[model samples]
Target: MNPVRATTSTTGALVRTGAIATVAASAATMAVAAVGHAAGISLDMSGAPIPVTGFGVLTAAFSLIGVVIAALLARFAERPRRTFVRTTVVLTVLSLVPDVIADAGAATRALLMLTHLVAAAIVIPAVARRLAA
Candidate 1:
């Protein structure tokens, strides 16, 4: 690690902020989705949207558990923001691999999408904010 690189405390703070925001954001989005469903809006369950929600739950769940996955990923030498955003985009797009490979049904597709979205939401801003220039 570079001597002038982000310090341990700075990395820790970044991860913590990402994690906290992820949980709050995921919960808020989920709650809003629930309300939207209750109000009869289209929730788009016919694709990879459902599992993406699981992504949020999983992301927040991991963050809340203090695993600091982002920190670990950020440990690489690249600039934090660039790394974070690139990784997120890659992961979100990768999450749909199953849907692309298999003739998944509606439920499966939606689940995958949900997971993808949640993961994206968690990965993006969480790392971006900290990695910001």
Candidate 2:
């Protein structure tokens, strides 16, 4: 088997795994938030109520965007593993900015931050591992 082909195949598989992991993580976050809301854990975002459906959609969309970034880094970066991990980490931290600044109460902000971290945890390692392989 050609080394390049093997590498490509591994990268493809890794990206797919990362994407799937991201989706699962995002869904889990949404489910947890929904349950919290059902249990009277208010997530009222400055009077802009976030519906369960909206939460799911937004989470999934952003997770997919992370997948795209991983794929792009795998395809284009000189050092895919390092670059992807670093980029995602920075982006993940940046993502917390909204939660921090939102007018939502402490619990809501914390939960929102948790969701972002969860998604990043799932995605960053998956893609980085593939790049290393």
Per residue, candidate 2 scores C-alpha lDDT tens digits across 19-77 of: 78767876877887888788787778988887766666777788778777767777788
TM-score of every candidate relative to the true structure: 0.58, 0.84
Model 1, global lDDT: 0.59
TM accuracy, model 2: 0.84
Model 2 clashes, total count: 0
Pairing residues by index, what is the TM-score of model 1?
A: 0.58
Number of the top lDDT candidate: 2
lDDT values for all models? 0.59, 0.79
How do the residues 1-133 of candidate 1 rate in per-residue lDDT, one tens digit apiece?
6754657777778767876677776775566556544655444444434432654475566444333545665566357566656766776677677655655555445544554565566546756777644
What is the Cα-based lDDT of residue 97 in candidate 2?
A: 100
